[model samples]
Target chain A: MKPIQLQLKQISYSYNGEKQVLKNVNLDISQGEKIAILGANGAGKSTLFTCMNGVITPDSGEIVIEGKKITKKNKIELTKKVAFVFQQPDNQIIAPTVLSEISFGAMNLKLPQEQVLKRVYEAMEYMNLKTFENRTTHTLSGGEKKRVTIADSIVMQPHIYLFDEPTTALDPLHQQMLEEVLEKLSQQGKTILLSTHDVDFAYRFAQRVIVFYKGEIIADDTAETVFCNNKVLSMSNLKQPILLQIQHILMQKGLLKQCNIFAKNIQQFQKLI
Target chain B: MEKHFEQIDYFAYHSPFRKYSAMSKFIFTMTLLLLCLYFNNIAISCYIIVTMLLINVLKNNIKLYDYIVMLSIPFVFVFFGCIAIAIEIHFENHIIIYVTKQTVLKSICVMARTFGAVSILYFFTLSTPIYQMVFVFQKLHIPKILTELMYITYRYLFILIEIQHQIKIAAISRLGYCDIKTSLKTFSSCIANLFILSLKKAQKHYQAMEARCYTGELLFLQEKQYYNKTTTIKATLYILSILLLKIVLRGQAL
Candidate 1:
């Protein structure tokens, strides 16, 4: 069994003491798990992300990171462990150039200048940011900026990366680039979690699916099981991934093999048939 | 508006001097400016102008017409300012436009001084990239806060310009700028909304910065510049020529 990297216990929160954003949330995320949080807009998905990253303190209950309860005092330390990538890459970019943007997190870790440089180069290599070392952040394309922001977190070498709508505005090609990055991170045994509205992406990229509805976790299971469940999909206002829907239709028409498992992507769909 | 900035940035990146250390360029321009001021000779000023024009046109391969157009506005401003002092309105009808020989001489001196100083500065601006300029300041051990402010301001200037263009295009698409009254309303609203959104974005940006362990200091990274012996020799030759030219003109004036 994998070690528990993060744990949340009975977390509850509200805005202005009247509207509850989260209610009795309990979750245990293991190390190296690629999990996707799926929800409709205003479904407390972002709020839960904030709670995990210590951006918003839950009104009730506590969050445990690596066996220690995170509080106002140790929140800064928690940031070193879990880095939150904001929805808008523009908001997260604090440096003028790409290299400095990546180095900001390393320098903040109190690392030596040499170590900072090493980490920056490594992250740049990993994110392909070397070509944009001197390019100003504002001048980068949407895809490049998103990659730079991801590099900003990668340089910190955090145990877990929290992304809020990481693929929101990226084109198809850049989205695939992000998918490759996620695959690489998971292979390195670094836990990755992202809240996304793309059902297809959630199904293909995430190993585990955590569905949220009306500020509560309605389902947490393997991607196949969670996506196959019609009740959970309806509760979260999510449709089955198009690939899965096509697979069902083809199977029913005897045009495809009667496989027990649903295909996650086009490649898988081709292989299963 | 963003297109204008893109043009400037493109020129800066392609500048012939972009390969050299920003410190070297900074030193050259500043030394020339001081020499011109110290000599207080119009010949020296004109010579400096010619040297800068040579570097910008011949070395950088910048179009002479573009350079002239860029400097024309400032040149006109200085000319009018000098003329304002030159003109002595003794009476309503007896308006003496060119008052005296002394006034004309003083006006010419002032205009030459202003143009010399401005031209050297413009040469620096046209030849140096923004990152290199930041490098010069960073090496001088300027305050981190100030350099960060400079960088952030420089970056967001383009973003704001782009946003202004977007707003203008959106307004024009809807005929918001078709009439004088509508144009006024659209521009006013656009400016007001920009302020509101900028403030909101500023706060969000601070939060995002904090998320990545931002602790006030924005660390600057350096790229390797190939400052070799030949480059050093060339820089020395250029500096010696400028100094020699200034001295020769000063001796002629004496």
Candidate 2:
């Protein structure tokens, strides 16, 4: 098994000492693992992501990245290891122009100007934002702004990324672009944890699925196992991915042979057919 | 408010003079403004105003109507200010108000100076983008906190305006502004809601910044712009002419 890149040990949190938001949740994430955290609204997904990125310290327990426990003194180093992309690009974009916005994080790291510019240009190119370098952040279209936020995260070059509902408010084209970017990041061995309501995207993109129900982890396993588990689905109020439903129906009708490995996406299912 | 802001920003970014170094442009505008203030002479002020007007209209390609509209906003205040200077009121057995030649000349002088100064500012704002000005500020070693605040405030101003626009549209669709009483209530409620929404957004913005490793500094990468020789030469010539015009027209009035 691959070495663990991030470990959350019995983490728990609450807002203003009131109701629990994260209830003694524990998770171990390996390097380059694509994880989709599935949950309904107010299910603690965003809170958990913020905790991991050190934006909000867990009320109890600790988070370790690369064997180093995160602390107030070393939170800056944790920032270097983990990057968080907010759902609202408007909130995340602090700089006036795209070039400056993308370089904001790298510059905060106090990297040399040349290195910062190099990383910014490379990230922009990767995200297809080359033409948008000087465009005002406010003037960009919804999809364009989404890419800018992802590019901003990319310039940080962190090993782990925590994205909060990345696909929310995105058009189909931009969503596809985001998917491609995530795939490339995973290929580059970056650990990714994204909270999303898109079941089909989660099924195709994530190697591991985590179901959060009422501030607790009800299920943690492979996508096939978690999505196929009826109890987990009912408790989390999540529906099966359409592809998964179709696959199950085919098997019930004896139109397809039963196999231990399920196809992750439509292309694979087509090959099976 | 949002439309006006967008139009100015659009012109600033699209202006032909944007190609020049912001430092050079800023220095040119400040020099003209200071000289105009020092001289306080109508000829020199008029010269400055005409030069800026030509640059904005001819070179910057700004529409004449738009330029007039923008200039008129500040001019209205100046005009009202000049009125106070140009006339004197006396209280005796009967109230008396009068305008003298000396007072009229003084008021015209003040008006000229203000127009000249405003024209210089308009040229700078209409031609230089905000990012370029921020770069200039950074180069001048302005305090980081101030520049950071400027950046954040400028970024959010558009967002707040957009929110206000959306709320106004929704209220209109719901007939919330169908009458005077309803309109006043709707406007006040919109202001209240905008305040609360902005505060929440500000908190989220700060958290977002912290998540990206923002310790205390907000750093950005600016494209290095070398001052073009021709542009620098032109700006120098313009500054010298303004000074020469002031010297020639010293103590002169319209």
Evaluated with DockQ, which candidate comes out highest?
A: 2
TM-score of chain B as predicted in candidate 1: 0.88
**What are the per-residue Cα lDDT tens digits for candidate 2 across A27-139?**
99999999999998999999998898888888999889999988888977777889999999888888889999999999988999999999999999999999988788889
Encode model 1's per-residue lDDT on A1-273: one tens digit a residue: 998989999999998788998999999999999999999999998888877877668899878899998888888877889998889887778776788778888988989889999999999999988888877677789999999989988999999999999899999999999999989998999999999999999999999999988889999999989988999898778999988889889989999878788877777777898
Please give the DockQ score of every candidate, comma-separated. 0.55, 0.82
**Root-mean-square deviation of each candidate, in angstroms?**
2.5, 1.6
- Determine the C-alpha RMSD for candidate 2 after optimal superposition of all C-alphas: 1.6
Q: Which candidate leads in lDDT?
A: 2
| Runs in model 2 lying further than 4 Å from the true structure | B247-254
Model 2 clash pairs?
none
Per-candidate TM equals 0.92, 0.96
**Model 1: CA > 4 A from native:** A14-18, A254-259, B1-6, B91-97, B226-229, B251-254
Model 1 Cα displacement at A130 (Å)? 2.6
